[model samples]
Target chain A: MHKIWAVVRREFVERVRTKWFWVSAILGPVLFAGIIVFQIVQSMGGAVRNVAVVDSTTDKLGPKVIEALDASGSFRATLAAAGPGVIDSLSNLVESKQLNGFLIITDDLVQTGRAEYQASNLGMQTIESLQRTLGKLVVKARLEQRGVNPGVVDWAQIRIALDQKKISHGKAVSDSATQSFFMAYFMAILLFMAILLYGVNVMSSVLEEKTTRIIEVLVSSIRPFQLMLGKILGAGSVSFFQFVIWGVSARVLLSLRGPIARALGADPASVQTMVLPHIPAATLAVFIAFFLGGFLLYSAMFAAVGAMSSNEQEARQAQQPVTYLLMVSYLSILGLTNDPSSTFARTLSLVPFTTPIATPVRWTAGSMPTWELAASLVILAIGIVAVTWVYRVGILMTGKRPTVKELVRWVRTA
Target chain B: MPEPVVVDRVTKRFSGHTAVENGAGKTTTLRMIMDIYEPDAGSIRLFDQVGGGRIHSARIGYLPEERGLYPRMRVLDVLVFLAEAKGVSRRAARVKALEWLERLGLADWRLRKVSDLSKGMQQKVQFISTILHDPDLVILDEPFSGLDPVNSQVLRDTVVDYRHRGKTVLFSTHIMEHAEKLCDRLCIIARGKKLIDGTLAEVKHTHGGKHVIVEFDGTQGNARQIFADRQLVAKLQDFGQQAELELATGADAQEILKALVNSGARLARFELASPSLHKIFVDLVGPEAATAAASGARGANGGANA
Candidate 1:
């Protein structure tokens, strides 16, 4: 045990001292904050477009269209009298960047519901806003023509919203669908990144020792199994440390969102709409358990891959199967999150390979049966033991990477 | 006290390849003693243990034939970590590591990464790491294979020092001169079989026949004629001013000396002594094996010598 601790200390201290660890650890939260800040800035609003409304219809609809577009606040609209040279001049204005765009209301606009928008570049948001304004005006004008009151039409246009709620423990919870989806996605990605990153770290560490021929000296002093275990635990601790840093920083960033938004010239209330989903203690526990189990299972297999490979290039080529396994589990996360109680999600949650990621996502996205979660944990534990057996045997055997048949043979015989 | 190690008919096979087919397993034997590889047949005892179940690694320091350390790690840290793995306390290991580093003339390089040092310096650091914890029995496989004469002499002196301190040092080398100079007891292996093993004197007396050394004043022309008599001299290795001869079975050494004197050869010196370890090794393993061993030593020493 002391030998194992020594190995663990060496692995941990050496890695933690490297620039890569700290850079990546801090980069995660920085990138995440950058995304959040970008979202907030985008929601605050974009630059208003300066455009003109050309009147070509027998009835003057240009001024009314200008009034509606100007009221929307996204476009600065000015009225222009329609003439043969009007469009050519507007096109030249757009070409020279003097004007953003122009909307032409033709005589057939009301009858044929047709209009032409000309711009150098048309943004989706600008188009959607313009469509909404024109549609409303056409409805209001039509209603007035049919002898209906304009006040009634305005009253009827008030928007209605549907409040989303999740049911938990036989009661309706106040969590929104968007919040639940985000929380599930965040947990799945966090678990997946932690397991894959730290697991590969273990593999590269093993490969370093093997290629350096340090394993001979190490195995002479301590058991190979102990050495591998120490490495896995050490790398796992570093990953967990990074996770703690990211989690705390995320929390701090989320709590300070209002001040940050205000500092960035965005309305604090717009940022406040991004309320985090409330994670229960039980769900957090499940996430941690699955993370650890998944890390162990994958790391042991990666260690075996490292052991069987003679060099870095060989190890990289050999690790594809293990990496693909993790990728398959990760790709299934979206499906599991969408329908956590579906048969596909439930089956994947029970399989040890996918259970670590799948089960946690399932539990967070929907109500999972306690027995299913227990069974998944138990099977994952068994998978860890089996992979550890392969790791113990493979770490000492150096040569070409073993085939799948040979790996199975080692597991069976060892 | 029991012997440091005893191997009783131990054999090890790796898949289709036989690592130790017969008794010629030198490195394989050391690995079994260290419990790095288990024996397929027979058993091994270390430090008087009944079976090679668990090795008392703290008591045994091993330097593998393939010499390497964590290249990116500091010399001091690598030594300390290895010592701690062998059950030494970190504080004690650190102090001992520094002492060894200084003794090996690597005190200034203790903080430098292993890769930053030259190959010879890295080798010295590896040597220090091997015995840093002060094990009772130190096993070195081809320890002097890649060392310069200066470094080799330093390591040789250290091995002798270890003996004076009552520690058992078992090292393997294909260079017969190193084995002849440093070893009290010697074992020669060939093709996974032990050709001979005993004290230096006993092996000489049993396998080495009558041997004579003659130093002549003149060049080889006169000596070659006298040594050309195959019936008198079984084998002759002629040097410019000196020559060593192995007498034929039942041949008298006095007769050869008389013949040299009568042939008008100026004799500087003549004496009869036990055969050298190199001669015995060549005689036992044959000329081909001797040439192969010599070339292997030269190749391994080429890096340091250059």
Candidate 2:
């Protein structure tokens, strides 16, 4: 045991000291959150734009329509001139950059309800401006056609409140409707990114050592399973520690969450109201089990690949086939999270390799049955032992590359 | 104490090739110490008390011809690991490692990566690692392959120290000089067969004959005619006017001198030097096997990555 620990501690220290690890183990989450916020900002910021419109229709939109559309104060719509670069041709205005964009109400507009939608991804702002402006014209036309004054329609829409009862069991109160979906998605994504980050971390760490020939010395002292276990736990602990800081940081920085999120380029609104309500303690217990079992079970196999490869580069190559399998699990879980009872997701959840990632996802989605989850965990336990035995024995075989037939024979004899 | 190693007829074979084929053609086999190849047809006892491989391998250190050290591992770390594995306390391992590094004049390089070290330095580090466990017996297969004079001496000194400390060291080297200088006894294997075994002098004694040198005056052509009796003339020299001649075993040197002088050949010089290890190796293992011997065994210049 001391020898095993000596091996483990040495591996732990060696890995933790490396530049690649500190970069990934410490910086990976920061980058992940950064990317998320960046995406949100990019998405929301691109949703609005400025545009101008000119009508060649027989029946033109009223002046009030433009004012009504402009009244929202979301974007600026410049009414264009009637010349060569006029508002009649959207292509010209956009090409000249004189206007951000324009909408042409062609001669058949009122008679035909068809509206074409086009916008450069770089010019996505044009989409919203056209929508808002044209939305006003349609509303105005409908009101006038219904013989209701536009003022009455506008005044009537000024607001009527439907007080929704937040009926929990028996109580009557109101809460936001979209909050549950947002909360579920947040929980699901958190479980996802956490698993992925650590799993790849396991892979990359194995790759680095495999490439460096350090694994050879390491395997001499401890079994490969122990090495893999120690690394998975050690790295997981490091990641877990960081995540704890993130959790505490979230609470301690509650006031600063907004600023931090913005700085990180993530959005607070995305995960807001996204908390699961009253997770059964048992389900959470299973999730923790599945998480550990999954990391160990899969990470051991990863360590095996590391052992088989002569260097880090080859190990990375060997890891891809397994990683792609993990990816399938992740994708299937994504489908499962949508409907946990779906045949595909539930079936994969039982497989030992995919179970680790998929089971927890289904649990979070509240789709896993208690017996099935127990069975998966049991299968995972067996896999851990069996794989550990193989990894431990196989790691020390020098210079001989075992082929599939050879591996099968060895396994049977073993 | 029983002999440190004893091997009674050992043999080893690979798939189709035999590495240490058999005990046949053997020089001298260790009877008391640990024998490396477990006898396929006999037995080996190590340290006088223990028998079998597990006992010997544990007590006896070995440096295989194959490179076995972790390439990227720190030199000190690998040494210390081996030391501790040999049952030394971690502290002792550290202290011993540093002492070895300094004694080997590698003190400044205690922390350098093993792979970064020159091949000679790396070999030295491996040497240090092999002996740090303080095994009573060590079997170094070609220990002095890639080394310059100075580093070779450092290793040579370390081996001497091990001997001074009463450790019995046995190493195989194709460098006859290293064996001549360091070995107390040897079992030279040629074509996977031992050719000779004994103390240097013992074997040289068996190689009887009072050697004679006939440095005839450069003009003394047809020198064989001067000592034309094939029975009296053991060999003739023909080295572009400087030929060496060894008289037949137990032949009188005076007879050759008389013959050459009677032939009116003026002698330039005369002297006798004991047979060198190289000559003995060639004679016993055959001239072909002698040529197979590598010249640079000692990093006499203190190089490790020779």
Candidate 3:
């Protein structure tokens, strides 16, 4: 036990002293916060567009179209002068960068309901907004011409947006659909990144020791399994340390959203109302459980891969199967997020290889059944036990890459 | 004291082939003594300890043939950590490590990363780590490898010092000179089997008479014919002006020298050979086995000497 602690302490102290550790720790949260800030600013507004309207209708609706576009506050519209020269002038305006685009409203727009808006470059969202503005103005003009009361039409318009609520045991859960989805995605990604980064770290450290021949000196005083476990736990601790910093930073940044919005000349209450999901205690527990269990399970396999190879190049090639396993689990997130309650998702969640990420995703999405979660955890525990046993025996092996048959034989004999 | 280390009919095979004589089994044997690998059939006893019980790691220091220290780690930290791993208290280990560093002339480099040090200095640090816990028995496999002459002499003195302090030391080396100069009792292994085991004198005596070297001013063809025709010369190697002859059992070197003179050979040099460990190794394991072992041929288990 003391030997194990010595190994652990050595690994942790040696790695923590490296500049990479501190750099990544600080950069992870800062980058995450930067992305959130950029998103908020993007949602606030975009650059206004200048456009020309060519109305060929008998009703002379060019002024009305310009008025409607101007009221949207995103477009500066002007009525084109009559004649073929109008198009040439508008094209020249676009070439001179004075106008972004020109919209051509044909005389048959009421019958055909089709118009062309041409621009040098346009984002889909901007184009959609322009289409909706013109659509509403055309309908309003037609209604006014047909003798409909403008006040009655305005009163009849509705703004309907669904309020999504999740319930458990006849009590409403305090999570919106968007919040739940993002929360599940965030947890899955966090766990995935942590496991892969740290698992590879453990494997390469083992490889480093092996190639440098320190492992021979180490195994003399301690069991190879103890060395392996010490390294895994040591790297795990570093990852956990970084994760806590990011978590705290995230919480602090989220709490400051109201102040951030007020600084940006927006209402604080509206920003405050967009609070992060209230993740239940059970969900958080599941997240922690899967994170640890999955990390241990995969790290053991990676350590075995490291032990079988004599150098880093060989280890990288030997690590392919394990890397592929991790990639498959990560990619299953797409299927999982699409429909967490689907039988396919449940099956994936039950598989030991994929369970770590898949199960937590389903749990946070409010779709994972309790028995299924328990069963998946049980399977994952068994996998951890089996992989660790392999690691213990495999680390003693040196020289040459073992064939798959030989590897399986070792597992059986061990 | 029950002989610090004893191997009785120990056998190990990796990938169904013998890996003993040429480094692979040397490491395996030492690891077995360290309890890293349990023998399949034979028993190994270390420091009089019983087989099924644990040996205190502090009482054993091993320098493996394939040696390495953490290159990114400081020399002092590496030594202290290894000492602490063997159950030494941190403070005591630190002091002992400092003393070792000073003794090895590496005190000035104590804080430098191992990779920043020269290979010889790094080797000394590795050596220091092995003995830091002050084990009763020190096992070193190929300890002189990758060492310059100065550091090699230092290691030789250190080993001699350990023996003077009443510690049992067992080391393996392919270079016969190290074993010849240092070991009081030596064991020669070939292809996973012990070929011969005894004191240096005893091993030479049991193997038989010494080999003789004779240099003379003579025609090369004539010298070859003279040696080839003689019954006393069991094996003869002609190197231009010199010829080395292995005398047959019970054959007298004086008789051969007289015969060479009578054959009209102008003698430049003639001497009765002192038996060397290399000659003994070649005689015991056979010249073919020695050559194969030298060339690193795998899975060759020829005849055993004992």
Recovery fraction of native interface contacts for candidate 1: 0.74
User: Which candidate number maximizes TM-score?
Assistant: 1
Give the TM-score ranking, best first: 1, 3, 2
Best by lDDT: 1
CA-lDDT, candidates in order: 0.81, 0.59, 0.76
- DockQ of each two-chain model: 0.52, 0.08, 0.46
Q: Write the per-residue lDDT of candidate 2 for residues A1-414, one digit (tens) a residue.
A: 444444444445554556765565446556656655555565453434555656554465524435655775554555543356553476765676655555556544444554553333344345555566566567657677879987887776565777644443244435433443344345445545655665556666665555543444344333455567766776666556556756754444454546656675665674343344554465468656876676677667666665566555666777787677667776664476667667777777777777876776666555456788788888889877766655554554446556767655645654
Candidate 3 regions with alpha-carbon error over 4 angstroms? A16-109, A116-121, A137-177, A244-274, A393-399, B18-25, B50-55, B199-275, B291-306
Better of 1 and 3 by DockQ: 1
TM-score of chain A of 1: 0.86
TM-scores of all predicted structures: 0.86, 0.64, 0.82
Q: What's the count of clashing pairs in each model shown?
A: 3, 36, 0
TM-score of 3: 0.82
Where model 2 places Cα greater than 4 Å from the true spot, the runs are A22-255, A259-320, A334-355, A358-403, A406-414, B2-93, B110-124, B132-139, B192-285, B290-306
Assess the local accuracy of residue A78 in candidate 3 as a C-alpha lDDT between 0 and 100: 86
Error of 2 at A283 (Å): 4.7
Model 3 chain A: worst 10 consecutive residues (lDDT sum): A267-276
Best by DockQ: 1
